[model samples]
Target: MLNCLIIDDEPLALQLLEDFVSKTPYLRLAGKFEEPLQALQVLKEQPIDLLFLDIRMPDISGIDFYRSLPYKPEVIFTTAYSEFAINGFELKAMDYLLKPISYEKFLTACNRVNDFLAARQLKEKKEKDYFFINVSHKMHKIFFDDILYLEGYKDYTKVHLSGSPNPLLILHNLKYFEDLLEDKEFIRIHRSYIVSLRKLNTISRKAVSIGNLQLPVSDNYRDGFFALIGEHAK
Candidate 1:
């Protein structure tokens, strides 16, 4: 369900949008305001997912108000003016609703928001679960949590996993994995070793322990490793 907020100066326009939201099953009315200034107080206290906003208002324009906001929710700009449509889209407004908005058009915009959010959530879940890489000739699936450490030998790298007796050897070097896993929880501690920061057990001046393996922390990579682990640079 989407928590919706409406900001319109027109009393009749505000009432119509409220009625439209009431008819929709996915939309829950969080707050409704006749003035843009009145809605500012409610915005601070509420976690609004969607906004039905008026483009032209007495005190402030909706386009200016949205631009000033620190965190903007998905917005559907409601206005009679066709000229402001370009301005609304520039701010990444989800949809532009002209005055005399039909219930059918409102629903079509809501469905777009729902579909976009659903796809984003699915993508985030898959990213957290696994990352695939070339293992021999086939693309191998490896869970992020299963990783212990990676060891590089010349042009090849071996990925060590928890509960596994032998590591999976890949054609890629440690430098290749280091660049690929830059945003992942893995960090390079030595020239030959890249360990998962999540699977770390203990750390000392010159070494880090993941599972039973004691990987050396080279001087070149020591400062970066410690900084990433939230420790003062050694």
Candidate 2:
């Protein structure tokens, strides 16, 4: 089970998050904090897997509090302001939740955590890895390393495997794979595509090649993708 914490000055927000956490079977509420300093103390004392943090607390802002930590848990930033969306992501938050957060949206955040945990387990399993993904008629076993890339289409995803003649189409999206693979070993070079890092052979200004397939990099993602490759370059 994942240990979760809710840090919000508002009593109602904390209660709602606590209730949501309680209903989720995989999560255990470690503590709730009205102050960011108190939450930091809790982190120093024990392990926490996830944090639901409100951005505008009195003592220290949530973003500042999050940055102050020596080690950080996966955070879902909860706030009324949409202005903080980009900044929250820059902090590497799991998700940015707009408050008066709906139960459905909160559940979606929990699902993201679940997918993140599952992918970490699969990576740890390594040689023993096998992922069962539901397709049209039945579930299919997919080996982790054999996947070349995944492309998200409207209400569906097309899985491009290493040597497959055709893409295996499934009802999923880029978001599903993003949460499922967080080791930074897979990258979203395009809004719709997540490519396996191990599969990349050469990268140029416009395209990245995996084997003989040259995939175009979207303009918006180009700089970040280039920086990632440069940072990890041999």
Candidate 3:
């Protein structure tokens, strides 16, 4: 199912979107927020595929709020104003829906999202050979062979590379990165850590060494983590 979040200040608008979301079989309403900040927090905490965003909002405008996000999801702009049409497309919104959205218009927007998602998935399948990292606010492509280890902080994750002095600090949830890196080369030894087997130096019952750094293997993932990394301690 395609998970989605609706962000609009108007209670009525949120209700309408919620109703529309429920009527669609392929879409699942992950959450709805009258406050954009709350919606942002939910997006950060969960995996959301689509965002129904209103253009105008208090404190921070929707355009600015959307730009501030490190990751971009398929967006459909919902607003009463038509002035933001050009700006919305500049930000690459999937489609724009005028207020009092009709079921037909909503279906059109959903079709655009599905088409865009399909293209993205096809691209990922073709490039399944490499991973991408965020550095200086840009997605810097990195091959799977270059990673050394991963460390999780409160709101960001650090990716240590082969020859780079500083690891890339990506604005992401550990679990999100964990899901993105579930291939054979990467293994999560702890809730807060993932390591590249290509860079594995050593392993113990409690800790796994990658390069000069030693990360603890937590009890929760120790078994599956070791199995992937070739430590079958029966």
Candidate 4:
């Protein structure tokens, strides 16, 4: 079910939206607030999938309130005025509803939200199979399996691959890739290096070799590294 919140200063408008939300099978009314400030507080504390927001509020305008958030939820703007429609769409609002909204219009907006969410999930799933990185001002599509290891310098990382003689220099830290490839077949053996477990050719007490490149296994990560290899041996 999609979690929803309503923020409208008008008592009648809030009640109408509450009624519509209660009747919808896929939507759950998380909260209804007349004060945008209180709604903003609830937003910070909870995860809301959809927002039904009023444009003009006494404390803070809905447009400004939405912009203030670091992580924005899908928004359907509710306003009596038509002037703010352009601004609302510019901020990527899912839909806009005029005051005294009909049930038909509301349902259409909800359907759009559902479609948007479904498309987003599909895109994210496809991204998990492969990722793109910038190399020499061009985006390079690198499959996880193609990567042999990663080397980190001060503020950049060198992506070493299986057949490439030269590594791709990317302006990102090793820690970024470490977190990105966490559950994938990659393990960080040293502060400045992460090696693909599948590509690891040999292991020693103090180091591991991927292809002809010898990378150090620091004491900080040695125990976990040994534990991982031990599992593979079993």
Give the worst 10-residue stretch by lDDT in candidate 2: 121-130
- Which lDDT tens digits does candidate 2 get at residues 108-200? 988998899889867675545457999888999997788898889977889898778898999878888877766547788898888888899
Reference-based lDDT, each prediction? 0.89, 0.87, 0.85, 0.91
lDDT for model 4, on a 0 to 1 scale?
0.91
Q: Rank the candidates by TM-score, best first.
A: 1, 4, 3, 2
TM-score of each: 0.57, 0.54, 0.55, 0.55
Ranking according to lDDT, highest score first: 4, 1, 2, 3
Which sections of candidate 4 miss by over 4 Å?
130-234
Model 1 lDDT-worst window of ten: 225-234
Best by lDDT: 4
lDDT tens readout by residue for model 1, 1-234? 889999999999999999999999989999999887788877788988899999999889999999888889999999999999999999999999998899999999999988887788667755776878888789999987898999999999999988899999999889988877776778899999999988888999899887677989999999888888884233
C-alpha-based local distance difference test score of model 2: 0.87
- The segments of candidate 1 whose C-alpha lies over 4 angstroms from its true place after superposition are 129-144, 147-234
Q: Considering TM-score, which of the candidate structures 3 and 4 is the better prediction for this target?
A: 4
Q: What is the alpha-carbon lDDT for the whole of candidate 3?
A: 0.85
Superposed on all Cα atoms, model 2 deviates from the true structure by an RMSD in Å of: 14.2
Compare the candidates by TM-score and give the number of the best one.
Answer: 1
Clashes of each: 0, 0, 0, 0
